[model samples]
Target: MRKKYVIIKVFKMDERGVKLYQPDAQIKKGWLSLWRQMFSELIGSRELIWRLFVRDFLAKYKQAVFGVAWALIMPLVMVGVFVFLNRAGVINIGTTDIPYPAFALLGLSIWQVFATGLTACSNSIVAGGSMVVKINFAKESLVIASLAQALFDFLVRIGLLVVVFVILRVVPAWTTLLVPFALIPLLLFTLGLGLILSLLTALMRDIPHIVTLLTTFLLFLTPVLYPVPQGKLFAILNRYNPLSTLIIEIRNLVIVGRITEPLRFMIISLFCLFLFLVCWRIFHLVEPRMAERV
Candidate 1:
């Protein structure tokens, strides 16, 4: 009878390659070491991450006649339709602290960052194609690089938001100075969800498409195009939805003078930090197997 063998691939435990197998395999590295390697590899791979970012960035805009302008187009159209409906009484989006156009555009800008980043990260590994299969480098770089494109889109939308503010002649609140700081939680939450979605997406090619559709559906529920409607329904709903809290508070900083839900925002931000660390660990653990799957 021929003996059978099962080969398992894993990250090396040390400078000398060491593999783990089932019950008897002892992990020589501590949890601190796991954390250290994750950061160290990411830091060491900075150049590769940059190269990937630039390659994808140029490849995306260079092929487009609209170039970077594509970023502002979708949100601009959404703002127009919503504003029209509000005026025509076809719908009531409620009142905003700023002009509705500025309000909706700003909200959409923030929301799209999450939407686009999620899609980009989810598709990243599969899009890397033969490179993922052949390369022995940090796969997280691909997710990060893809996410950069969404951020580029975000910067473009920021310019549009500024234009809307100017046209509306709305000077933002004094707290607007804190806009950059206020945005940290939003960015972290998006990255945390993006990391987890990327891993799921690698296992199933259809996952990215589903994420895009789901985010679009979520936009309606999220108060992105409107102020939260009156009554406990939306208030309670927004309270539970972390994305709603992030958008509303960031917009509040820009226009409303204070965070309406500071406690909730703080809680959500802390949760996002925890989620990011956990998701990152999961991604790192499974990264060695990603090449074969992708």
Candidate 2:
């Protein structure tokens, strides 16, 4: 018997070799399944949504020196500053019979709620990037969580407003009931814008900076520190600025104890609903790409 030796050649594979050899059928199916699963998972995970909301609420003041008292303190400080400025002829409140401090407080209370809601919700997805990438819950829940925290802050600030109102001896009338109705459109409007901004900011890192700048400009445009004028420019600003109608309506019903313009409220409400639908659709469209981008 003759001994024979056989040599076999083995091919070495690079990192890309495995990927090239594998079929993408499972990957394509997975992505399709994930897209279909999003809505069902969102509906099924209400508990996680609530938990995230509560966590966000607590996180707002967790390590702060003043804790939640900062909420009450902030609006009070704003009212004080505006009152001094108005007295000094820096910012005029026009001929309104209400005291300057009270007027300022009322405007700040409503404006701060909307502003904070918009700010927090806009950064929500970016802030939750870690969870978004790692966790399997509904992404929309992040926006809801952020809004809930903002609402909590709003309610706390309202309590401070009640204290100030009591001290000022300004009795709220039946029109006070309309305050919540007025707030509905404002909330919807803020949440819509927040959703739009949140998704955009996640895609474009520069958006958050632009948003901050725009928010500062918007504050001056809004009638938070002064009454809306009746001039041509003011009229145009009021009609177009969503916050203008919302703030004016809130001040009229809550602080002024009257409801002189119901039609404006209806128009604002309709606009907010339209914005909500548009933002919701946009959010759904961009959400799939969020994890990939973030």
Residue-level lDDT of model 1, residues 36-81, one tens digit each, is 8789988998999899999998998898999989888888898899
Off by over 4 Å in 2: 1-45
Best by TM-score: 1
Model 1 CA deviation exceeding 4 Å by range: 1-25
Looking at model 2, the pairs that clash are: none
TM per candidate comes to 0.90, 0.82
TM-score of 1: 0.90
Q: Over the full model, what C-alpha lDDT does candidate 1 score relative to the true structure?
A: 0.81
For residue 188, give model 2's deviation from the true position in Å. 1.1
**Candidate 2 accuracy as lDDT:** 0.75
Assess each prediction's global lDDT (C-alpha) against the native.
0.81, 0.75
Q: Quote the RMSD, in angstroms, for model 2.
A: 11.4
